[model samples]
Target: MEKPLILVTNDDGITAPGIRALIKVMNKLGTVCVVAPDSPQSGMGHAITVNDTLYCDAVVVDKDAPQKEYRCSGTPVDCVKLAVNEILGRKPDLCVSGINHGSNSSINVLYSGTMSAAVEAGTQGIPSIGFSLLDYSLEADFEPVLEHVEILAKQCLEHGLPTGVVLNVNFPKVSKEGIKGIKVCRQADAHWVERFDKRVNPLGREYYWLSGDFVNNDKGEDTDEWALANDYISVVPVQFDMTAYQALNQLNNWNFSQ
Candidate 1:
C-alpha cells in the first residue's frame, strides 16, 4: 500500500522543538513535507501574507531527509497555502499543524496560528488537525502527546473528518500516566480577562505589556476546559463557518422588510 502524504506545519517556526517533534511523529505515519514559518508567528489567526512579499526556501534542515523541507517567511496559514499551491507536486492527504508549545483550547483557538493553520487547510477541503500542549516552556517535553497524536492522526486518515470541520486537539501539561484518556468535547465558553501594564522605557517612551488570566465561565463537564482540567486530552471538532444559525429566524421576525 502507498504511504499517506502528510503536510506538517507549525506557527513556532521551522526550527522550533515543537515542529520538530511533530515532524518526527508524522514521519512514522507517512511521507512528510514540512513548510513552516521562518520565525515564530504564534498569535496570528488565519492570516495570510498578502501585505508583504512572501519567501519560501528549500533547505537541508535534516540531511538524512533533505528534499521535503521548506521554510517560509509567512504565517502558518501561508505555509499551508504555499505547500498546497506551489511546493508540493501533489495535494496532501492530510495536514497537521503544531504540537504547539502552548494551549489552543477554548478561546485561544481564535488567536492561535496553530489552530489557524488547521482551519486554513479545513477551508481548502483537506482533512486537518491541530495539536497543542498546555505547557508553554521552551523545553517542555512533547513525548507524552506523541502517541496520542499518532492515534488521532491515524483515526483521521482511516475515518476522515466531516465537511468544513477540523480537530482541535489539546493535551494537558501532565505526564503520560496522568493523561487519563482522550475526550471528545465542545469548546468551552471562556475568555481572557486582560490588563495592560503601562510603563516607561529607558528612553522615557511609554509601553504596555498585555497580560491576562483565562476565565472559564461555563460549568459544562463536556467542555474542553473541563476535559483539560481533569487530565484528559480534549478534541474539539471546529469548523470555519461562523454563522449564528439560531438567530436567523429571530432576526427575520424583526420585520426588516418593513
Candidate 2:
C-alpha cells in the first residue's frame, strides 16, 4: 500500500518553526509536500493573488529529503491552489495547514490564513485540518500538540471528513499534561472591537496603530472559546459556505415595497 500523500502548508511562512514542526510530523504520516508562503501571511483571510504574478521555488530545506519543500510568493489559499494545480498535479489524500503560532478559535477563524488554507483544500474536495497552538511567540514550543496533531491527522485519514467541511483544531499553550483532552465544539460568537491608538510621527504627522480586545459574547459551554478556556483542545468543523440559509425567508418577509 502506498503512503498517503499529504500537502502541508501554513500562513506563518514556510521557514517558521511552526511549519517546520508540522512538516516533521506530516513526514512521519505520509509523503509530505510543503507549499507555504515565503513570508508570514497571518490574518489574511481567504485572500488570493490575482494582479501580481505568483512565484514558486523548489527548496531543499531538508538535506535528506530533498524536493519535498516549496516556498510560494502567495497567500495561504494561493499556496493550496498552486500546490494542487502546479506542484502536485494531482489531489492529495490529505491536506493539513498550520500548527499555527497562535489560536484560530471562535471569530479568529474568519481572519486566519491558516484556516483559509485548509478551507481552500476542502473546497477542492480534499480532507483537511488546520492546527493551531494558543501561543503567539515566534519560538513558541509545539512539542505538546505534536502528538495530538498526529493523532488528528491520522484520524482524518482513517475516517475522512464530510464534504465541504474542514476541521479547525486549536491547542492550549501549556504542557501536554496541563492540556486536557480534545472536544468537538462549535465556533464561539466573538468579535474584536478595533481601537486604533492615535500617535504622532517624528515629523509631527498623526498615525494610528491597530489594537483591539477579543470580545467573546457566547456564554455557551459548547463553544470553541469555552473549551480553550478550560484547557481543552477545540475541534470545530468549519465550512466555506457563509450563507445564512435560515434568514432567507426572514429577508423575503421584510418590507421592501416602496
Candidate 3:
C-alpha cells in the first residue's frame, strides 16, 4: 500500500514555528507536501489574490526535512487551490492545516486563515483538519499538543471525514499533563468587541491600534469554549454552508408588500 499523500498548509507562513511543528508530526503520517503563504495571513478570511500575479517558489527550509515544500504568495485558501490545481495535480488523500500560533476556537474560525485552508480542502471533497494552540506567542511551546494532533490527523486519514465537513481542533495553552483530553464539540457563540486605541506618533499625529476582546456568551457545556476552559482539546466539525434554512419560510411571510 502506498503512503497517503498529505497536503499541509498554514496561515502563519511556511517559516513560522507553528507550521514547523505541524510538519514534524505530519511527516510521521505520510508523504507531506506543503503549500503555505509566503507571509502571515492570520485574519484573512477565505481571501484570494485575484488582481495580482500569484507565484509559488520551491524553497528548502530544513534541508534535513524529507517532505517537499513550496511557499506561495497568496492567502491560505489560494494556497489550497494552487496546491490542488497546479502543484499536486491530483487531490490529496488528506489535508491538514495549521498548528497555528493562536486559538481559532468559537467564532474565530470564521476569520482564521488556518481553518480557511482546511475549509477549502473540504470544499474540494478532501478530508481535512485544522489545528491550533491557545498560545499566540511566536515561541509558544507545542510539544504537548503534538500527540493530540497526530491522533486526530491519523483518525481523519483512517476513517475519513463526512462530505462537506472539516475538523477544527483547538488546544488550551498548557502542559501535556495539564491537558484533560479531547472532546468533540460544537462552536461556541462568541464575538469580538472591537476597540481602537488612540495614540500619538512621534510627529504628534494620532493613530488608532486595532484591538478587541473576545466575549463568549454561550454557556453550553458542549461548546468548544467550554471544552477549552476545562483543559480539553476541542474538536468541532465545521461546514461552509451558511444558509439559515429554518428561517426561509419565516422570511417569506414577512410584510414586504406593505
Candidate 4:
C-alpha cells in the first residue's frame, strides 16, 4: 500500500500557527505538499489573480517539518489552482484547507477564503474539506481539534466524498472533553448586520471601517449554527452548483410565448 498524497492550504499565511498545526497532523497521514498565501487573505472569496502577476515560492518555514511548502502571493483559491496545474505532478488524494483562525460557519462561508480553497479543490473532483475554529485570537489553541481533524481526514480518504461536494467543518471554542460530539448539519440561514464606523485621519480625510454582527435567523436544530452552540463540531456538506432546482419549474410556467 502506498501513502496517500495530501495537499494542505489555508487562508491564514503559511507561517500562522493554525496552518503549521494543520501541517503537523497531515505529515502523519501521508506525503504532504503545502501551497498557501504569503499573507492573510481572510475574506477573499474564490478570487483568482488575472490582471496581476502571481508568485509561488518554495520556502522552509520549519526545518523539522517533512512537507514541501510554498508561499503563494495570491488568494487561497489561486494557491489551489497553481498547486494542481503547476506544482504537483499527480493529482492529490485529498485536499484540506484551513484549520483557520476564526469561524466560517453560516453565511460567513460566502466570504471566507478558507472555504473557497476547499471549494476550488472540490470543483476539480477532489475530496476536500475546510476546517475552522471559533477563536479569532492569533495564539488560539488548536491542540483540541487536531485529533478530530485527523479522524475526519482519514475518513475522507477511506470513503471519499460525493462529486461536486466539499465539507465545511467548524469547531466551537471548547476543550477536547468539552466537545459533545460531531453533527452533520445544514448551513444556517444567517447573515451579518453590517455597520461602518466613520473616522478621520490626521490628514482630515474620512474613512469607514467595516464591522458587523452575525445574526442567525433560523431556529432549526439541524443547522450548523445550532450544533456549534451546543458544543458539537459541525460538518456541513457544501456543493459548488448554485442552481435552484425548485425554481426551474416555476420559471418554466411563466408566459414567454409573446
The top-ranked prediction according to TM-score is 4
Q: Output the number of the lDDT-best candidate.
A: 4
Writing each residue's lDDT as its tens digit, candidate 4 over 133-231 gives 999999999999999999999999999999899999999999999999999999999999999999999999999999989999899999999999999
lDDT of each: 0.93, 0.94, 0.95, 0.96
lDDT of 3 at 231: 97
- Model 1: lDDT equals 0.93
Tell me the deviation in Å of residue 8 in model 1: 0.4
Go through the candidates in order and give the clash count of each.
0, 0, 0, 0
Which one wins by lDDT: 2 or 3?
A: 3
Q: Candidate 2 has which clashing residue pairs, if any?
A: none
What's the lDDT of the predicted structure labeled candidate 3?
Answer: 0.95
Candidate 4, residue 96: Cα displacement in angstroms equals: 0.4
List residue ranges in candidate 1 displaced over 4 A.
255-258
Worst 10 residues of 3 by lDDT: 45-54
lDDT (C-alpha) at residue 227 in model 2 = 96
Weakest 10 consecutive residues of candidate 2 by summed lDDT:
59-68
The CA root-mean-square deviation of candidate 3, after full C-alpha superposition on the true structure, stands at: 1.2
